[model samples]
Target: MSISTATVKERSLLGLKELSRDEIASILDRAAHWDRQQEKMSPILNKHFVANMFFENSTRTRFSFEMAEKRLGAQVLNFAAAASSVEKGESIYDTVRTLESMGIDAGVIRLKPIGLLAELAKKVSVPLINAGDGNNEHPTQALLDLYTMKQHFGELKGLRVSIIGDILHSRVARSNLWALQKFGVDVKFCAPANMQAPELAKYAPYVSMEEALQADVVMMLRVQLERHGEGVLKSADTYRVQYGLTEERAAKLNAGTIIMHPAPINRNVEIDDAIVESPQSKIFTQMQNGVPIRMAVIERAMK
Candidate 1:
């Protein structure tokens, strides 16, 4: 399941827009192989330097990227928003330019505003991987989640997957919808009235949480506390009652249906703490797959 370098001609991964199905499959397969043989190979044997520029607070994505690069024998420089020159009002362009001037191999960025990655991509000469951009997308997370699903179900096509929770502010939900739809999965979404995703018409929508939970795969997204300022949700308790996946709610899911989440989970907020540790949970595996998937992405971009 290795992707020959000859197969992927494009040298950058600014977005998922340019990839075809076979290319995506190849990448996922390669990632899976890397994950299984993590100790055996050092793909990035030379001291290649990779920079992580994260504007928003993160734990899983940042660490995952760092582990991925380092495991492949690359050096990693992590720049947190609070510690960086961004605190001095230096613009994103200047920060990226400064890093590029250091001769880094690639940049993994997680910014807040929509289209910021696109803007950054235009300015950087090296490969720019969009770790996240506002509520727009988290392509790497989506790739890992897709890879997790394929591992669980043995295929991607014809699988029914429902993404439930705060869609309006979740980059994970948006990316999952696109990746699932592209991979031929039947995608559905569930959220409270006010928290319904903005791009509803693009994918199947389930007005009730119950309906969405009936799918073969159920994914719960963490509620962004920042969205409370945007008037999207009134209170955490109210959101939990209306849309959270409680033990009773989990009972409604189809038998053996896989449940997933991108981490830093709010226990009893989006999903009950009990369910997160249950056998049905794939949330941790999703986090576990992040490393190899990211490694594959960096390797692909470097070529």
Candidate 2:
């Protein structure tokens, strides 16, 4: 299960917490390059075979990676846990090893287990990319978010960003906190007491929702309603009044400030339905930006 340090470092996209600023910048720059391409398809990865393995359910992340891989001309294999042998109790490692034995050039994996991706990277010879791993980090999501911000603002330094809602279970927030700090961006969090991630307080301040809306970016996280039992959230209406980006609150934002949400949005829970597509909102832009950013990431792994 042991691997060389060079192998692990060179191939895996485990998380952004360990990546240096320059390393992150390079990925963004590469993503920008990919974004500029007018051609719909490139054969850079022509002969390479890559696998998209997901042990957890996903919609955007799964399809985004698939689109990126195909756009680069890499042969692709898709695996879903619900439809696979995993239902019969096959271990993740055994499944990955089975794929490795089939000659996949690289693997894109999403599993629910925290910290297992790092451990899996060490044991697997082929490079592994983290799709979204159990609230630990969603590096590609952060990468695209960084790319989108850089595209609009021209620089990340000194930019103010407040990530509001569901911080406790958001891998997006964790990944963005680590990556944005590398560029000297001021990142803050805003959430209800029960929804906060206290461990991250040392890294970023938890601000009042009123104060959070004053920032350069108001990034709303999806309210994880499934995690909150009946008593946990009195009702969606209660959460909206206290923390959701209602139209009144959105109207109060500075004209220059932008709105954001990593989607599967709750429509009226975390943000108003009317604001989801407003001029200031980058909700769809984030999804579009994901493809090129992911292209940059998959290219890095395959090449």
Q: If scored against the real structure, what TM-score would every candidate get?
A: 0.92, 0.97
Candidate 2, residues 1-303, lDDT tens digits: the string is 544658656767999999889889999999999999999899899999999999999978999999999999999999999999999999999999999999998899999999899998888888899999999999999999999899999999999999999899999999999999999999999999988999999999999999999999999999878889867788899999999999999999999899988888999999999999999999899999999999999999878
RMSD of candidate 1 to true structure, Å: 3.5
Model 1: per-residue Cα lDDT over 182-213, one tens digit each? 78999888877677765664676665777788
Off by over 4 Å in 2: 1-5
TM-score of 1: 0.92
Candidate 2: Cα lDDT at 195: 86
Shift of residue 5 alpha carbon in model 1, Å: 17
Number of residue pairs clashing in candidate 1, backbone atoms closer than 3 angstroms, sequence gap of 3 or more or interchain: 0
